[model samples]
Target: MFAFASLLALAASAAALQVTQPSNSSGWTTSGPNTVTWSSVSTDNSNFSIVLNNQNTYPQYNEVLEALIQTSEGSVAVNPPSGGWVAGTGYRVNFVKNSQDLSSLLAQSDDFTIEQSSSSTFSAVPLLRPARPRPLVPCQSPQPAPPPLRRLARESASNTDSSAGSSASSASGSSSSTNAAPGLNVQTGVYGLLALLGIALA
Candidate 1:
């Protein structure tokens, strides 16, 4: 019984040392292609890393690395030089560090047949949906349609015609009065002739 209890305690301790993926409660989210980040985990001490197998066979291993780092943060550092991978490749990741050489790290046994290199990350957290845009409102009340321009133009023309008619009528009346009056010179000549005849007769 004592030995069994000790074994169970040892197993529990080992389990506790194992690294766990971050929880969804954390704000961390996975984004981009072929990349994912552990959330709720302490970024300061916890190191996240991935390993690619059959790199020569897979053409997109390097692209995966670039896309992974592009999507996740808190990498601390990367190894094996960047930009290396081929199609039909397998890979694995280690959340914790074991040694400087990283020989004991987990490696994926299955091969990955590349199909248009995946540039997406597997996130434990839910994605945040973008907020909807608000409807636009006019800044000021729309000015009532300007008084119909055509109506204003017509009214102005009517006023002008009425004024022209009044002026023409006044001019015509003045000319008629002048034509009716006898010439001053003709009246004076007639009076002078009458006076001369009267004086001669006298």
Candidate 2:
């Protein structure tokens, strides 16, 4: 019973060494800093080892970044080395407590993306985009093209014709007033000659 109690306490302590941050499906920028977080750790005596794993490994599996850091309560952050993480790469943050056995894995975060672009779906590969508003049609009915100006043009032409006829008639009257008609002069001369011949004969 005493041994069982000891084992249970040991297991409890081991479980207590866990990670709290870097949740599943989390994303990070490749060139920017990233935070790796953990919880329930004893900073007084224990130390920590931070590891960054590549889900897409070179041969079988790979560790891209590793550090034997001192234990703390909060988190660890890293700016990946040049070309450390590429776009579309999957990674994980692991917090391994410095223990004698070193076999136990204290905590490991879920796999996440390392992105090259910040606004690309927040993930390495862009999958979603905001929808665009459709263009709006005018509320007023589409006006039919203005009726052709042919009627107005015809009215203007008719007015021009009437004015032109009036102008021509006025011009004719003015010309007649300026000079007597040649036919009137010839008729008056003939009547005078007839009266003179009649008077001479009498």
Candidate 3:
């Protein structure tokens, strides 16, 4: 009965050694400075190693994150290798007791995700350019203003008088001064006829 009780205590003690951080709710990225944390019942200062595993695969892929580390310090920072981790879920971190021929399990984290880095997933947004102002219509030259009403009437009347004078001058076969008195041509003819009559009588 005492042996059975001792075995139960040992099981309970083993259960106490577990990974605390990077729980099922935790998420990590491939290009990470992420953390893995654990708790242990053993008080010794022995070093341990950390391994990241992809449990989603059939054979399960394993990668040794740290060859030797003191897990009792509660946590350690880790990063994926040069190419970074494969982005997926069902990944776990395991703590193993340092040994020559590997066969000692210490603690293990729950299933979590190792996603593609945030930087890689991000896309650049194009800057919004202010709309170009609508091209201005070219200005047109102003038209010349019309002549005043009084000046227009004056010009029309002057043109009509000049045309009437030209037609009258053409009809009258006599060549006379248009600007002289109207009776001057008839008076000159009468005077010449009278002088001729006086010369015949003499």
Candidate 4:
């Protein structure tokens, strides 16, 4: 019975105690299913849990961000609290057999990095609007077109000829009667008959 008890104690001491993931170069985001892996010498039935800690709060393990799982799976995915981590380095992963007891630490990984997720770190940007167009000016009324040069020249020549004919008719009245003889001037014929009768009587 003593030998059996000693063997059991040794086996229990050798159970899940070595962390294999979240190495020194690992970069885990606060909002992700970051993989946490470890080794266990015990049977597959042994349960384990994970915790996130900051390297600045080292030996005390006070700054602990608890994961949302406790299972027997040696390798599992754990997401840190959305509001837990800031963007920086020097983060560590802690493996524990019981989440309620930090004293039951099973394994500890090297210092890794935790950062703010892209979704949470984003901010809203303002949109750009197009400029307004200027108002148009009103148009003025059109002017009337001038008379054509060809028509003006024809009217000027007709007026000149009419004026010259009127001045010549006023300068010579008897010549004007002779010029009207084609239509038989009655004044000229009467004056000629009276002069012939006077010549006969004398």
Which candidate leads in lDDT?
3
lDDT scores in order: 0.45, 0.66, 0.77, 0.70
95-193: candidate 3 lDDT, tens digit per residue: 777644334777778888877775753346899999989988999999999999999999999999999999988867454545365678789999999
Where in model 1 is the C-alpha error above 4 Å?
1-145, 181-185, 198-202
Instruction: Name the runs in model 4 displaced over 4 angstroms.
Output: 1-16, 43-45, 57-72, 82-84, 116-202
TM-score of each: 0.29, 0.43, 0.50, 0.43
In angstroms, give how far residue 2 of model 4 lies from its true place: 21
The lDDT-based order of candidates, best leading, equals 3, 4, 2, 1
Give the least accurate 10-residue stretch of model 4, judged by summed lDDT.
60-69
Candidate 2 segments whose C-alpha is farther than 4 A from its true place: 1-15, 43-45, 64-66, 97-104, 118-202
Error of 2 at 196 (Å): 99
Among these predicted structures, which one has the highest TM-score? 3
| Candidate 1 backbone overlaps, count | 16
Which of the two candidates, 1 or 3, achieves a greater TM-score against the reference?
3
Per-residue C-alpha lDDT of model 4 across residues 81-174, encoded as one tens digit per residue = 6565566777777766677776677678888877677675344687878988989988979887888999899999999999999888776887
Q: Write the per-residue lDDT of candidate 1 for residues 1-202, one digit (tens) a residue.
A: 9999999888655533232222223212123323333333222333323543345533533222322222125332332234333233243334323333445442222333333335443346788899999999869987788778899999999999999999999999998888766676678889999999999999
Q: Relative to the unseen true structure, what is the C-alpha lDDT of residue 18 in candidate 1, on a scale of 0 to 100?
A: 33
Least accurate 10 contiguous residues by lDDT in model 1: 21-30
Clashes of each: 16, 0, 0, 0
